[model samples]
Target: MLDLHNHTTRCKHATGTMSEYVDTALSQGVSVYGFACHAPMDYDTGFRMSFDELQDYFHDIETLQERYSGRCTIRKGLEVDYLPKHLDSRVLDADVDYLIGSVHFLDDWGFDNPQFISEYMRQDMSQCWQRYLHAIRDMAKSGLFQIVGHFDLLKIFNNPPDDSVHEAITQTLESIKSAGMALEINSAGLRKPIGEIYPSKQILRKAFALGIPITFGSDAHAVQQVGFGRESAQRLAKEVGYTKMLDFHNRSPIVCRIP
Candidate 1:
């Protein structure tokens, strides 16, 4: 199995050391694993790493890669938020295996944060949904990331917009296809109130029809969560007619059979 999205203590909300995560992946029989801790933003969010810690984060992963060389493949990566003006170009220029671009905030309201749930409730659901989708499309067209993380994370509260949101979703998928970026089938949503994977079956089917390349990400924040829900992710891909999943090395893709 392969999982490309994971977090560490550097991302304040997550637990476990880089070694612990690698050990857990080995136990889970994961052949390829990527450490993609939330990248640091220009300002403090309290959930991600600090800008100064980025070098340490990269070095730690590099050390683990050598330590676990024969046991499993470990790729260095980051889950970078798509904040246009605040984006840290270092993340894009850094020597890493891949980058997972995600939309976690709309303007200043972070829709995914638990503390901001009430703030999300106050906004017009339709407007928020449309804005979120447009942000994702912009992230895809930016050409700075190799993977799109959790395409439908706005449904974290189970308040997904109506079918009218399809146009925006289609536009985002088309942008990702044009940018040659892969859509991540994130399994973390299962642990949230949403109780389903990101991008839903509806979106997944459309992405398949659009010939968008797919990748799997557990979005693990802890050791036990590594490779969690991988089987379900694979089943969803198979049902959508996907025979393979894309893996990355230095931002280049390698096709592997969906297992």
Candidate 2:
């Protein structure tokens, strides 16, 4: 199994060094080891790291990659929040092997009213969905990431949107396919209420119809979380006509057969 999305201590939300994660991957008998910590930016957000430490993040991972070069294939990668308004082009043009594009916020999703956040947290499942799919369309057009992370993350905190949302979801997926982008089947959502991958079965089926390649990621934030639900995620990919999981080398996808 392969894991493409994960975080380390470099990002405020996670803990541990590159080596610790690598050690866990080796022990688990993984064929590939990826270090996709959240990308450091010059922003002042609470979730992202400072760009000043970007070099440190790269340096530390570079050392671990060399140390484990013969034992395991270690790679340097990042999970970037791709808001075209806030993303600095220089950050994307860094030395990392590849990056995951995601939009955690649109102009910060900065709701001022406690009620907006609470209401967002409490919307009649359908209303909250209207807001999320709108956000997703904007994210897809932003053109900042090659792999879209958590195609339906709003479901993580709210209720699932219905068939009405499928039209917009399909349009976005088609655009992603036309642009030669891969959509990720994130296993991380299994811990949530739906207990299924983001985008669900219907969306996955639509993605296959649109001719998009599917990728799988644990979206792991800790060592033990690495490769979580990966076997099932692979099976889900196959159910939707994808026979291989996505691997990136020099920013281009290199498909690896799933067993």
lDDT of 1 by residue, 1-259 (tens): 8899999998898877778888888887888999899998885469899889999999898888899898899999999999898897787788989999999989988888888788964788888889999998899888999999999999999977588888888888999999999999999998999989987999999999999999989898887888788888889999989998899999999999887
Best by TM-score: 1
lDDT by residue for model 2 (224-248), tens:
7877787778788788788766778
Stretches > 4 Å off in candidate 1: none
Whole-structure CA lDDT of model 2: 0.72
lDDT score of residue 256 within candidate 1 = 96
What TM-score against the true fold does each predicted structure earn? 0.97, 0.88
Q: What is the lDDT of residue 227 in candidate 1?
A: 79
Clashes in model 1: which pairs? none
lDDT of each: 0.89, 0.72
Index of the highest-lDDT prediction: 1
Provide the global lDDT of candidate 1 against the true structure.
Answer: 0.89
